[model samples]
Target: MRAAHIELTPTEDDRRIARYAAAAIALSVVEAAIPMPLPGVKPGLANIITLVVLARYGWRDAVWVSLLRVVAGSLLLGQFLAPGFFLSLAGALASLAALGLAMHLPARWFGPVSQSLVAAFAHIAGQLAVARLWLVPHDGLIAIVPFFALAALLFGLANGLAAAKLLEDAGRTRQ
Candidate 1:
């Protein structure tokens, strides 16, 4: 049987999204290289990109960036379809869901900082749930919550501020 050949071409929008996704993936690889004092306590610098995309583009675009970061990042790290990938995917989906809802809030009251914090907490919750149910399955895992929460709060706020600055710079450059 002759093998059917299928060719797919990327549109301009696809190319744009690919650029953003590549940026996010780069951050992910860099984050993975950094040594962490505590498990799952990295600063999540990649998420700052997500926040910017969400504000400038939309939630759907942000979701694409986040999902691509997880899948492609994991593949680059040679951890595709592994336990870590699953946890990361779960965390990303949770954060995206929170961002989706948070975007509906008033922009004045709920800016990038608020949205970042919300996503960070949601990410931790999702990862913890997966860790408890699938990875460890022990009550002791709950003990890590307070620490993770604190990390999420601090990193989330910092990432939010960074994203805000990036957005501001982009706006200025565009003008």
Candidate 2:
């Protein structure tokens, strides 16, 4: 009997996946650059990239990409440990969970639009819960939920449309 050795090689698909992840990270940075009037609120344009990654690569990759985006984005913004950063982190985690659940759903049950909507809602709920429990002791922040939820709806739709377009393009290229 002879000992066997194995070496790994990067296939074309692996290279493509790496490129996609890089593109998603870059998109996340750009999304973080956009400013909103309210504090700790964002359209989370990077989520579109996460959604596309989830649809194409699956849940694990999406979670990794999303976590990377949140951590890197927070560092880049110099917001590490700030309330906003924690809020964003909470939202990202919730969004990842929601996306994972959505991926497990029947294909016909929820399209990208509905998936994004649900994820956005979950993200908001998570952030609100964290804010109430850890950041703010009083219920003053509760008043903003409706406004944030409305914004989430609009931004979620936009993110979903962008993700859908990206997925369509990726599918076409694959074919």
Candidate 3:
């Protein structure tokens, strides 16, 4: 018996997405190295890439980049299929939903900063919900909301500003 052989051709978009995903994954690794004051309070540097992609490309490409980051980052960090993986998955899904909605807002009014803030809150909310329902299963989980919210605000704003700068630079380079 002979097995079937298949070949897939790569499109320009596929190469672009792969490049973005690689950058995100690299950033995730760097983020993992930073010392965090709290367990789930990394700066989420990779999300800057997501925001940039969202602004420049579109939500669909952004989604692909974001999910690839989560999956590939988890695998790289040796957390695939673990509780942490699920938590990350939930947060990414929630963030993507928020981005999808936020993208529809007026571009002049709600740029990367506002969109990042919205997605950040949604990301933390989704993680908390998963932790409460599955990991802790106690009302005690509520105590961490304020902390996470603060982190979300600070990190979201920072990432958004960075993305905006990158976008600005990219635009300059293109012209």
Candidate 4:
């Protein structure tokens, strides 16, 4: 007879994971409040929380945190189902995938800043693709890629540095 796979229920430690997820979501909301000159652009400070969760809690929990952030952020901003919401959702999902893949890479090969750059680039690319394919459906929008790339690189570096610093501090405390 073949054995079926069984999933185990959460223990006390699992509750901690849930708490981390909640914290990540809350951080995202707070990050949303900080404004930039551009309307749609953001520093993505919340990514620091996501990165911490991914490094500590694992990818599955990180995903839950990210999804909750997107949903809650949209509702809070009163832009649910709007183009901005879709763009944010796409960017978040893309960043999650990039971060997941980066986590599996050898630690020496990629550090926090590099991982953040890759994830940021992926997020921008994903949103642009969505815009071209579904939202705009016109070639004129392609012109914005260079600007977005520049912004993503700058903000991504900042976010990556912040996350790396947080991680370093956390490690120091643990030691």
Best by TM-score: 3
Candidate 3, residue 125: how far the Cα is off, in Å = 0.5
What Cα-based lDDT does every candidate model obtain? Answer: 0.92, 0.82, 0.94, 0.82
lDDT of 4: 0.82
Q: How accurate is candidate 2 locally (lDDT)?
A: 0.82
List TM-score per model, in order. Answer: 0.95, 0.84, 0.97, 0.84
lDDT of 1 at 128: 93
List, residue by residue over 48-112, the lDDT tens digit for candidate 2. 87888788788887887777777777787788788988888899899889888888778786778
Q: Alpha carbon lDDT of residue 26, candidate 1?
A: 96
Instruction: Kindly list the per-residue Cα lDDT of model 4 for residues 1-175, writing each as its tens digit.
Output: 9799898999865687667656766776776777767665677777777877788778887787777777877787787999988998899899999998988888887778887888889888888888889998999987888888888899899988998899999999999
Top candidate on lDDT is 3
RMSD to the hidden true structure, all candidates: 1.8, 4.3, 1.3, 5.4
What is the per-residue lDDT of model 3 for residues 1-175, given as tens digits with 9 covering 90 to 100?
Answer: 7789788999999999999999999999999999998898878888999999999899999999999999999999999999999899999999999999999999877789998899999999999999999999999989989999999999999999999899999999999
Q: Put down candidate 1 lDDT per residue, 1-73, tens digits, no spaces.
A: 9799998998877787788999999998999999988977778889998999999889888998899989999
Q: What is the alpha-carbon lDDT for the whole of candidate 3?
A: 0.94
Q: Residue 99: error of model 3 in Å?
A: 0.3
Report how far residue 79 has shifted in candidate 3, in Å: 0.5
